[model samples]
Target: MPSKIQKLEPDRTTIAIGLEGSANKLGVGIIRHHPRPDKSSPKPPAEILANIRHTYITPPGEGFLPRDTAKHHRSFVVKLVRQALKQSGVSIADIDCVCFTQGPGMGAPLQSVAIAARTISLMWDKPLVGVNHCVGHIEMGREITGATNPVVLYVSGGNTQVIAYSHQRYRIFGETLDIAVGNCLDRFARTLHIPNDPSPGYNIEQLARKGKHYVELPYTVKGMDVSMSGILAYIDGVANDIFGGKPKYTDDGAEITREDLCFSLQETIFAMLVEITERAMAHVGSQQVLIVGGVGCNERLQQMMGMMARDRGGAVYATDERFCIDNGIMIAHAGLLAYETGYRTELEDSVCTQRFRTDEVFLAWRDD
Candidate 1:
């Protein structure tokens, strides 16, 4: 496609521009990876040249559809790319590769962004690197938190998994048997008619903070896997009943409020996550736990995870919204790593899929 893959010189800095529109959010980011003087040394830190995103939000009690989300991404991707390049202060010619999310997302949204990436790759004469969405989260989390090797709990809207690195792959130790954790929260938020302005999950977290009671919900954890669909269905019914003026109360005779439902749901789901994550850590014989993805931004989840890791005499690592939420920077960082290892995705093979799994990606940049 391009002339020839550029060699990553040890003394040179590699720059990549990444585009991400896997879901409702469209993002563009530029990142710089400075190489170590000694090639045998461990990798150095990455520099975030520019990180920008625009979200497509629906009204209260609604979810974003694939068609609308794709339109939103198409509308903003080019503008975001331009802004990212300008903010990075880097010329297009200086970019080594154009990276984009290739899978594990809504088909239309992923295709919309991939088309933009393909167009840029051809226009700028740069190679293209297709990144796995889940792998992008893991790589960016490791870079931001410096968690060398940790049992990763990846919680997002479309996916939920507990992972560990092994044999040049991110192996999924356990995952949701039903809907994802974030999806459960989002659906519950819709049941409550909460605003999806910032995020339904964030609003739910805020409401949960004011809760003084806990209404027990189904705890579905079978072996290492967890289930949230039943819980969501159960809670949805409870929420509807409460809204319909049905009497519901806690064990202490206190009437359960909306805030209490949010609180109880958060606690129950987070506990299931903690249980699986701890089990994964034990299975891998590692104490470190790293949380990534959009729902990983939940402070309650982080606190609970931290408590679990501490109980095992280890530490938990998590990032704020910037790195935790889906963004182009993570795609850029992870893609650049693969690019440096001589991985490339030709134009024809750069097609995006909606069902890519985390374990499907080969971690060529990491040792066995």
Candidate 2:
């Protein structure tokens, strides 16, 4: 932790509106941060005035495209924004700043949401705060679960990383060298013809619950990082073989089912995650583990993480879909924290990107 830099005065409250549409979901959220009465303490508990989202679901055997996703965001963002403001009962003038995710997502969707956010900031005369998508998830997880200084396992459709804080930065201890864990699941779900109603991963989790056989799949963990491309390719090939009536079976001569495939994939990938997260925790000398991002909502992953943490005599912290999934509230929550440290994204510099790493942002509000 670095020396505290004075930004906000004591006992003052700041309200922010956040916009998020990095991928298939477009979210609008309102958040209020109240400075602690005692300046020595950290920021007080944040209030989530309103957090609303609308998702764009594609048909089975297909993944969402950047172009189509952006169109969906453009269509629904304004409606969600209006609903969020009305639900929060906060007037536009009450908002202190407008926050939006600036990077680490699909280019088209990010740009669409960025345009919306810039419009809002200009219209409301509020300052803009460009937030990193991964940091948003991490900070919101810490705030919601009160897990300070825990090792973070950020898993999502486009990212997989093990993170920990050191020297005023959220350092990445490990990450995926290939496809993300969620991407593997989503693609596999498509191969199985699973519906993408709520989410492909959620549907796979449900199917995995009915699975009894543990079909062996390649479990590849390279040191602190994991690679899912090979696993996905192997599973897809097996699924194709099964679909072609080519008879695939386990080593014990038992036939494989779609349920078994999902079960094996989940168990194998989650174990690799737990292994790497545990390794990072041990390296950092911390026991607490916090899981965030879209894939963190899986109950089985939570259970596996809890077991790993319990074995180390620590605990696992997590949030439900509202905070776990890509949403505006986390962006608002994290951007508010940065804004408290006098961080601002000038209108001219409020550009969105597709490759913002977690360690790029400097943690100015932290004194730990």
Candidate 3:
């Protein structure tokens, strides 16, 4: 870590442009951080000039593939960047740095966006900042909700973790041992042949709302970690049985429907998540909890988490879809924070990986 911090004059503002294509969604964002009025004053909220995203949707029952997603990103990255700059009313010269997701995602999509970031960095002669995808979600959640040092529960298609900031790092207290919760839900939706438009998880949530009976499913919680693969497999078998003309009944002898299965799966998995998150909060002696990542946009999860937080005499913080889902603004915000601390990714070191851990990032901007 560099000992020198980048300081700005009171009248100066820091600007950054970020690109994100870690999965199916390709996004571009521009943001500005105004200088603080004084050293003792609180940091002002970030001003989002433009936050644009375009997701590559597959047909029903299909998930996004790395190559296809990368192709989609290459097709739209430049356009989105131009639109973001136009919407923000800022020129390339005004941007202090270019940020992009560095890792913990699909290889092709990460590389596609990285190439764009590097091009922008060279074309505009701005510094490059490589941001961890998970860190982007955490910092964006904190900024949007104004939650100061709360326990973070990051849930997405590829990740599920309970994290807390400590010793200049976001340490993981718990995580999924198998597939992530969102992955389970998404795969279950595919099993049901549900539409992927607007997200399969959202469709499942809608179906779950109409379910009157809850079928039993596996609940796997091991110590501080949770497992969803068993539950997914079991539920998938049940769904297949129903589709194969084998009638499945609930405890009340009512025949199980797809909606009922969706309901049961969601309830069981969310309960497991709540249990572990509560345990983490208890261990850390923190009442406040912040939920981030794409799955954090689920209203049912938010409601369940909120209920658990209230029971602990605390509160739950979550953002809407725009910020909750993967977006470039988060990359810009987190990278700019690092850039303000004299952090930069040299051209030779500007590489993206497929398996970057959240704790690998050193939080130079944070003291706690």
Candidate 4:
């Protein structure tokens, strides 16, 4: 077992290197954070020394596999690490800790990056920090947008949740009971044989912009929880029938186009998401809504969220694609925050899992 590491004073500046490979993307980032003595004072700026990422793209109509994604991470993680260190102008000796995503992701992919992080920690003689993926997104979003204690709507291929911070814990107000929102969109893209070069969801969004009409699809919102699997199934059937030269008319005899389906899907799902997010904000009495995770980059979703927040006399906050998508900067930023709070993952205890929940991590850094 690795020896117990000593805690550092929170008043000093700390540097952390974070590795993220919870899914198809592999990222390496370095961050420097300066903590202030006064807890109520403004949060000090967290500098991004280096932030680099690479994605593994599969063919159209295909989803990424665990083994393949792991291999992809292992193959490029070293190169990314080297590049990030060089880009950041920081040597291994300058880093105070190494961090990695621990869970709520693919088991093999998470394991692959965790192994790299553990090896790096031992090589550099730095302590290890385990980061939660969802929390990483939330923290990064807050830092970039300066949304203090906002309602977070985290949407990605693997997760769709409405969250609010309370008692130092990020509580989930609502989430998808089945497949996530991004997963639902990707599967529907596969049914339509859409290319997955950049992202299926991106392609769908682009196609949606060309649509002038809407085709009806099931909108499954059970109170705060949503059921996207049924909607995906229905859309997939519609896409298959349309592609198979079957009747392409709605029940009202209106013609159904591919663009129409995409538009309708985006409108329906995004509206559902906005509804749940608004509900969360109302429940928490928060005026700000912050959207995080990969799918949060969607413009239509942002527009819908903005409208909802405006209706409630509130505001919506979001980051660009760089921070919105899963990246190393988030993990690095979040991990450094934890490290300052005296949280570290010993080498022997840095085991990665596939089911780590966001609320599992104790919040020692936040006073609110």
The candidate 4 region of ten consecutive residues with least summed lDDT is 1-10
Tens digit per residue, CA lDDT, model 1, 1-368 = 12235566668899999998899888888999998879688777999999999999999999999999999999998899999999999999899999999999999999999999999999999999999999999999999999989999999999999999999999999999989999999999999999998999999999999998988899999999999999999999999999998969877789989999999999999999999999999999998999999999999999999998999999999999998999999999999998997788989889899999899887878984
TM-score of each: 0.98, 0.97, 0.97, 0.97
Query: What is the Cα-based TM-score of model 4?
Result: 0.97
Best-performing candidate as measured by lDDT:
1
The CA lDDT of each predicted structure is 0.93, 0.92, 0.92, 0.90
RMSD of 1: 1.8
Answer with 2 or 3, whichever has the higher TM-score. 3
Error of 1 at 330 (Å): 0.2
Give the per-residue lDDT digits (tens) of candidate 4, residues 57-104: 999999999999999999999999999999999878889999999988
Runs of candidate 4 with Cα error greater than 4 angstroms are 1-5, 37-40, 250-254
RMSD of each: 1.8, 2.3, 1.5, 1.8
Q: Which residue window of length 10 is worst by lDDT in model 2?
A: 1-10
Q: Which residue pairs show backbone clashes in model 1?
A: none
